[model samples]
Target: MEKSGENYKVISCGDVASLGRVVLHDALALTGAEVSINELPAGVSVPFVHAHKNNEEVYVVLSGKGFLFIDGEEFAIQEGDAFRIDPKGERCMKADDTSAIRFICVQAKANSLEGFTQSDGVLSETKPSWL
Candidate 1:
């Protein structure tokens, strides 16, 4: 499901607990980043390791247990764990044999962030509707 207005859009990604990946770039008409919600069942690993040519990736584990293999090093990951990988870092993920894993991966051009919330946000005279 989706809804849109002049400058905002919202989409519902029902039941991320299931196994699969849902890419939101095209769905949300994203211009600067690609985001995906992914789920892997127990004892499964991505078929191949991969690295991006220009974009770095950040992964936020939403549930369960997993391991991230990056540049031949393995790191344990579980709910609330987040990590960033450089553009050229070889990476793959596997869910532990005991449970499924779900995560959100966000990719954007490496070194492209010049300003974040504190520096970029501007106070507005307009108040939020609920206020």
Candidate 2:
């Protein structure tokens, strides 16, 4: 499901409770980032190891167990784990034999964040409806 207005958009990914990938770039008309929800079944690895030319990626593990391989090193990941990889780092992921793994990956240009949150937000006089 999706809804949009002049400056905002809301989308529902439906049920992400199974093994699959959901890429949100085109769905949301994103201009600056690529985001995807990925799920891997037990004992399965991503089809290929990859590195981005200009974008760094952050992954947040939402459920299950997995191993993240980055530049020849392996790190165990599970629910609530989050990590970032540099643009050129080789990376791949595999779900453990006993559990499927689901994660969200957010990719954006390397070194592109100029300001965030406190430094970028302004106090607006308009109040939220809940207030």
Candidate 3:
């Protein structure tokens, strides 16, 4: 059974995997959505290079430099770069031999606009309490 509570999920990239690359799945709890962090070693590319049938994705580059392939086209990416991919677009990425790549990938059903907007978020006054 699940209960309401406040918790923190602290993780380190090395903790997820020690291989040349790693994909940390469901790093955070998000309803109707998915989040993952990918760490790619130099010159290594993601294994999955296919398109999704129903979900679109956003890639946020956290560190290093790399190249992204979308729909058979290539684009250079770097730290602080963010881009979206349509569900029907084929995608993959590779890190440069000089630097590794760390990025976050968010995925959600394309039709669920409301879900992407965080409409379910609640704003409430904090309960009266003394520290």
Candidate 3 global TM-score:
0.75
Pitting candidate 1 against candidate 3, the one with the higher lDDT is: 1
Residue 6 error for model 2, in Å? 0.6
Query: For candidate 3, what is the total of clashing residue pairs?
Result: 0
- How good is model 1 by TM-score? 0.94
- List model 2 lDDT by residue over 20-52, tens digit each: 888999889999999999899899999899999
Model 3 has an lDDT value of: 0.79
List clashing residue pairs in candidate 1.
none
- Candidate 1 per-residue C-alpha lDDT over 97-128 given as tens digits, one digit per residue, 9 for 90 to 100: 99899999999999999889999999889998
Model 2 pairs whose backbones collide: none
lDDT of 3 by residue, 1-131 (tens): 23335764455556433554444454445666677777788888888898999999998999999999999899899999999999999998999888888888888889777642367677667765872
Off by over 4 Å in 2: none
Model 1: how far is 19 from its true place, Å? 5.3
Give TM per candidate. Answer: 0.94, 0.94, 0.75
Q: Which window of 10 residues has the lowest lDDT sum in candidate 3?
A: 15-24
